[model samples]
Target: MTVQSIAGPRFSWRGPSNGWRQREGRGPTLALALFILVFSLIPVGRLIVAAFEGGFGAFWQVLDAPDVWRATRNTLVVAFGSGSLALLIGVVFALILSVTTLRARTALAFIMVMSLMIAPQISALAFKTLAGPASPLLKLVGLAPAPGTPNPMLGEFGIIVVMGLHHAPLVAITLASGLASIPRPLIEAARLDGASPWQVVNRIMLPLLRPFLLSAALLAFVAGTGNFGIPALLGLPVGYVTLPTLLFRKLASFGPATIGDAAAISVLIALIAGTGVIAASLLLARSASRLETDHRIEPFWELGRWRPAVEAGVWGVIALTVLLPLASLLATSLVPAYGVRLSPSSLTLAQYVEVLFRQDLTVRAFRNSMLLAGGAALSLAVITLVSAYVLDRAKPKVKAFAFALIELPYAVPGIVLAIACILLFIKPLPLIGVSIYATPWIILFAYHARFFAIALKPVMAAMATLDDAVQEAAVCDGARLGQRLRHIVLPLVFPAVFAGMLMVFLLAFNELTVSALLWSAGTETLGVALLSLEDSGLGAEAAAVAVTATLLVLVLMLAMQMLARRLPPNALPWQALAGPDRERRG
Candidate 1:
């Protein structure tokens, strides 16, 4: 019964640094290392190198250019404007749902996040169709502006509003994490001291949540600077330009020679984003921001008299921002053309029919997108199994570096990755002499790079939760590494891995920015095709494409929701937002 007897004489203690690496994980370690280097490291390095090809001459030259300077200023302006709006909206919603007695929190959170889940281009399109003189929906309501009038949703105002609405959930979700950590006793103590709810929040909560506010603000700003779909659909038709759209336009207009200039601009954007991230981290690290306590989080703000009014206002905002735009998109899709008012006789399914079944480009786009998205998700899921395992045994510094590298592909703007991909693959492989540059393989590669961090995250988190003793016992019992992985590790983490794959697919499926820059003839994704149809004045067809893409995303998200019941808490983010009261969260 003693320890020496409980463990056999042959039993040896294992630590992260000892038996795992000494015995089994080398293969997976090597595999994940290679994967990271190829998919994440090379593209980023190539982009940085390309930007400084002439030893900072071209870099400084691009930064000094009038167009570059203008675009940078515009990006800063839009980012600031949109981030401010998003901060206001998101903070209001988060406080209401997380602290106040708000009804329909789940439904409201779902709708808010859905705005983000739907592609930014689709959101832009929906808002666009709900405005202007040519709007079929507005025309039916007799609210359409006079003919020849410009779309109100076509410049800085529209881009800022639309982008703010689309990104508000991001700000909300970030702050929700902060909000969930608040100790219940603090609020109780304040209430006992005769402090009003608003006073408590202003005096205590706001001070504690400064780190989250800073993080949320910087996150929104970075997202706005990197956003392509909103500006593309909203700002590009006008003279407005941001860095992402500017880089996209240059590459699209001037051809291959512009890649170098695009790289310089891309570097500039990456630097800005990087600076914000680093500053946020430094501030958070330096500040005494920890809020951990034994007390559970509980809502103390009871809106006894104002509940109904708040509900009405919330729903009214939802109607204006969510329901109306979506209804307009669907209505416009049903019509014969952009300006064709919706009526019994004017309704036609031709656009859906054409985009879904008939048009060659549309057909090819669907095929290519499905293949790219599916391929990337499947690839990342498999990659995560190995990468997560490797990282579980990796030292802290190595794991952190690996994670940061994986995130770089997604953190840097899609346009930067697109330019880097072009640079990296423009030449044939050194040995294989095979080029994937303009091929579907290139897009697939981009998806893997951009989404690998997302796929690895959930799996790594799940991996950390696993019982180390069980795996160690398996090792002690002479179960081979692969066998333990197949039987013990896989079943436990499968839910997380699947969740990661679903997230990757969801993000990759509706992606536009990366594919927009990287697409070629016959290789267009649904996003690219939607943009093409819209640019060609085929508004109905474009709406059809957007609606189709949104439906697919909805179906996949629904599947994830269904699967979420059996999975860990917060496996799907909407689940966390859906029911923050389900458990005593840390």
Candidate 2:
């Protein structure tokens, strides 16, 4: 058919084409430009002002102080040590699970993700209750030492271990995804060519997974460097100070100079984290671009006589890394006293009851957590959806900048964002009438800024996969922009929207560093309340609260997994792995 006949003789080619392009491209681009300017640039500008105005001078003057040097050294040591440990464990676990005939593969996957959901403070608390000076396990092992003796697990060693354990699941998940993406045929071919298992793994698996491994490790390093909960909970008791803890101390200290120095330190940490993220991205892109796709499926190998032994070893590692600390926490929460041996006589539900019913703070903290998380999740979902859609539909000239701005927070740490929020909102703007301090809304805002990038990622990824032709077809059938979005776009992108909401809610509910700094007496989150309880020597109550928070987070994560499963087939990672079978169903 002729073009004119097909489209209609009355239709003009140039007018509609131009109008549609401008509507889809120019309108969204302008919106994104304004959004970035308001959300990212303004807050960052305030941070820069705080950093240079008086903070820079004071920070410079104290840069050479012994205490500053000690803190810097401690920070690097803990970050690097924990990062290295996490990398080793993650790589080993990934290898075993991906390449072996592991019996509990599905269970292991759940366990790994569950470990990731456990907050760092909770993990540290668990470790403390398991191995601390007053721990029942220590006494049972005859390693409790003297009553006044210092506990080794409450110092630098404990901080590194807790951080590593807290972050290892992230590393494992990232590396496992990369490993699973590797074509199985290549490994089979290497084996058929007489390559040993070790040789094939070293030559094939390692090289192919390098980019993902590096990205995971670098991300973990950034997290470890900025982490406050583990260090504060474990290291502070032993007089160890990391950069984030130092910044917190400086801010809480009743001195203007200390606050300025805190601002300077925040700026420095943010810059370092930003640089690491950029470098990792560039490296990953370069490496991935060089890789050629291999299409081959290999059969799973039988472990023969060694299968049982290998399976047992895999379970042992998982138990040690995942189950032990969790059990320790659950046991401690149920026990009456830590120093007493864990027999039937020592078990009690009194701690949970005391914390749940006797303490009003527990109820208040739970309410505050729900409020903060709900606000953050709702705000983040709206902002991220708008931002993602704008970036997805914007003109080429502005799209790149908008996307980059949205992603900038991925590099910035929570502590830095919290500091920036304080700087920006302390002085009320014309539109906003009051200071943000001690307000639950401030916690919500800080969470939105800190986690906005995480929400944007999945939404943008889902948006990218959508067929633009459907929208065009709707338009051709007389659907307006709003109608098309409401009827078609929303339904298709619902999975992504849900995923984004789930992630934001999970993060906001469990967040510590940002909330710790921003929380007021009346607006304390569960995490902050738990920390307070711990500091006041209410160990049993703190453990109960930690256990309760962990359970809530786990439930939310499971709900998210179920929601993802109900999504259209193409929207899931597992469906993609199923290949032709999944395609036919979709």
All candidates' lDDT scores? 0.85, 0.72
Clashing pairs in 1: none
lDDT (Cα, tens digit) per residue for candidate 1, span 528-580:
99998988999999999988888887888777777775576665676565454
Cα lDDT over the full model 1: 0.85
TM-score for candidate 2, residues paired by index: 0.88
Q: RMSD to native for every prediction?
A: 2.8, 4.3
Q: Estimate the TM-score of every prediction.
A: 0.95, 0.88
lDDT of 2 at 141: 60
Predicted structure 1, TM vs. truth: 0.95
Runs of candidate 2 with Cα error greater than 4 angstroms are 1-21, 24-31, 54-59, 136-149, 180-185, 255-257, 292-302, 337-340, 394-401, 567-586
With candidate 2 superimposed using the best TM-score fit, by how many Å does residue 326's alpha carbon deviate from the native? 1.3
